[model samples]
Target: AVTALRLISPSTALRNLGAATGIAGFIVASLILIFYAIVAGWMIAFCLSSVANLLGMSDFAAWLTSFGLWRNILFMLIFITFTIGIISAGVKDGIERWSARLMPALLITLFLLVAYVLTLDGASEGLKVFLLPDFERALSPKLIIAALGAAFFSLSLGVGTMLIYGSYISDDENLPVVGGLVTLVDISIAVLAGFLVLPAMYVALHNGVEIFTPTGALISEDTLIFTVLPELFATMGTAGIVVSFTFFFLMGIAALTSSISMLEVPVAYVIEEHGLKRKTAVSAIGGIIAVASSTILLNFENLFGLVVAFTTRYSQPVLGFMFCIYAGWVWHRDTLLQELRKGNPDVEQGLFWKIWPWYVKLVCPVIILGIFAQSLWG
Candidate 1:
């Protein structure tokens, strides 16, 4: 199967451009993993801490949740190591199997947590705020741009991760249908998450935890996961410990799933392009990312937010724009049509066949560039 790097065009120069795009994507993915691992480590730490709480080791649990440099580094290494171990085992045995098991578990846990949180006092207010959008604020260009970024990043659109994953799909699968289902699932999970988080925030406030500032902004908006939710759990007594454990465990699974894709982008590149063994690629790439993660941890005050903004805010949309260009303009139209026909011979008569070619070719590139320009200068 052709890798993402080779998917752009048959022409030599355009193929090199595709390779450069892939490399840029690899770099951005690495940068994202640097900080992403740190937060993922927090999820692991919180999971263990909840277990400690369950065992009545309150002090140990507190220390585990504390933002200690050593604790952060330890859990970060552990998370990266787990990622390496999984990818090293190869895709069918490692990625597919674990993802098959964990994703369902993650969803089940999310549903249960949402149900429980909604039953708490003040949760109705949160539900109202979440479901009832304020049109005035929603129309803000800034909010719309941010929303676009969130959607793209959440779906891993700009990254070669999805492109690489697509290469694994059998030719018999309908690409549009598969892509739609994936999008639906992703959006459902995100919405379900809001059902849990927003109501839980209000519940925390009801339990006397500080959730809002004087200006009505959320307190510790950036650190809400590590702060408000834990305090909210503490208010629930024994049940809180169980809930906290379940919640953090859910978070850990989510982190692991996402990190696997990010790491796979580069690992796939090295394995396919450099002729390296999967294990060697996983270890070398994972180790280098781990070192970069350590660097961020060491200089947390300075580099953390900078890297986050650079990768997610700036780099992602730009890469996504490039993907739109390659897909819509560079890739031959007949080839794309032929590829679509592999799964459905009558696809040419379908609505997607009629709309998508032009939509992706013209509409997608324009929308992506508009988003990029807004984010850049807005």
Candidate 2:
């Protein structure tokens, strides 16, 4: 769908985002990308922690505590360096190859972890909570609103990411089938993550770790991930180190997949617009991101929190609406149909094809606008 954004000026194809909207998208995306490294830095930090545990570093925690800023800088530096290197290697060798191996392995690791957690004493309760949604809470206005925002974020929709990847697809491939497959895999991973993490949460509770704060409210996400989960692993003794290492390593790879895609958007634009080589473009973008990430890392909570709120509360949903509007209204009706019909060039316009034009134009904007208004001002 996003391919259309890059499609109008088709010579560069996957290498370009649209003119005005493209710039707007990049500016909006810049916020999320900067803070996202902090999130990714957490993964790298945990992975390093796991490695230290494996090597029997007695004072690793003390060392990390004393040198927290520098330690984070190192991880963030490594993360940016490796991410830029991978993307600069070009799509087939870099993105696609790593994705082929990492995505499958990510799923397997998640399943195995889920299976292991399910064997714990309190696992069944976790499963019940995950599997059975609380309809009452779900029906609440707040929850419904959150779910709507979540849908956009989880799928990485409304970002030009889809457009970037869409340009990568070969013309002979069936877009609908491919899109559906990608979506299903994404949903599967989310479900599996819940299966894994929720069970671990219950297990943590069974081990007498607090899932909630002393004030009786739920603990913050950062505390749950960095503190509570590690405590859960501590209870398992020696074996937990290996398990924890594996879990964090799995997550690090998962985070890389998303990071690479985010980086590629601006990287592609630079390459096309400036005529720089892939490596040069990647380096330029990497340096920019690294500078931004370093500032956030150094500033810690206040600036980081502001960027997160801006991206989640304002930029992302707005950009998503823009993508929806452009797709539905700006691009010609026949063009979308043609793109959809790439693998099946002669496909007839049934009721679906007939209604879709008007649907995306009329329905999608209204729905997105409603969600955006609700999320921001409602």
Candidate 3:
């Protein structure tokens, strides 16, 4: 009966589904945070650590001890300048061009290391532990939630990032195909990152050193990739030096790409909403982010938690909900389907029109809101 209703009134069903999703509130919050602050903190942290290490710091902890607050402030300025310069150029000219050049090199380096790991003596054991899910092991509700969040977050979905990128896409581009490809690429990178990190960890364990567990660190997964992976690479002998260079080099690129998207959000907002020129808008936004980042670096404390908590609990989920609403509801289903069908003229409108409404309206929004509430309360 429900299937008949969906088939009979596909467009209306989709609209009703989108309305039921309840994503309108959270999506607005995400847009604001993305345009303003979340990505800036991550960029600030990346630049300070990357630049300092490139200059041969003994350790990040020791570098912090020696460099003090002003050095990080300086780092923030450099980071903002670098970010704004690239973002102001627009995505095709800036992001796509640089990514085209850099990503291939990064991938080749990572592949070599993965090949080496596969050939390692105890690699089979490490691979099994990572790839095979063991049901017997106690599954914490928290870890399951985290994994799901990571899956969505890491894909760069639920935010307007994909939508903004989509806007730049040519009419010839296949929407569904391109979206699926991007999702696959992002997931592959995350899994490859795990492969690169985990085998080296077990190698350390075998050699009688303490292995770091996910629960052992206060830092996020990205930080662990940046900071700790260098030490892991050091375990490999003469090849270690090359691996270290590749690891940090690849990491720097990943950090920069994500940061560029973040900076573009505000720069594009100003350009669209206000009549400001691109260069001028970039400068203003960059300066604000640099100042805010410097403040965070100088006084890392409870405020960090507060900012992060607010963004995660309210901002991210809201933005995600908003994106679905915008794409699913606000944008006419016929219009969206028309766009989707543009490059792929032979594509059928059967299930897409039916499932899409529920997905955008009722399903995704509720799941995201629930995740946010759970994060905040639990």
Give the top-scoring candidate (lDDT). 1
TM value for model 1: 0.96
Better of 1 and 2 by TM-score: 1
- Candidate 3 lDDT at 91 equals 72
The positional error of residue 111 in candidate 1, measured at the CA in angstroms, is 1.1
Is candidate 1 or 2 superior in lDDT?
1
- The per-model lDDT (C-alpha) reads 0.89, 0.77, 0.59
Report the C-alpha lDDT of model 2 over 155-240, residue by residue, as the tens digit: 77666777778888899887766877888988878888998888898898899988887886767674477777888888888778
How high is the lDDT of residue 263 in model 3? 62
Of the two candidates 1 and 3, the one with more favorable lDDT, higher being better, is: 1
How should the candidates be ordered by TM-score, best one leading?
1, 2, 3
- Per lDDT, what order, best first? 1, 2, 3
Model 2 regions more than 4 Å off: 1-18, 65-67, 214-216, 346-355
Candidate 3: tens digits of C-alpha lDDT, residues 1-378: 112112323487564544333233223323333333433334345434545555666487345424356655655465566667777776778878866876787678778778876776666667877889877553766565556565655655554455456667899887777877987888788788778667765664555445556677423444454445445545665465555555556655665666666666556656665779888987887776666665666565645566656655555665576565555555656766676677777555556555667787888777777667667775
Question: What TM-score would every model get versus the actual structure?
Answer: 0.96, 0.91, 0.76
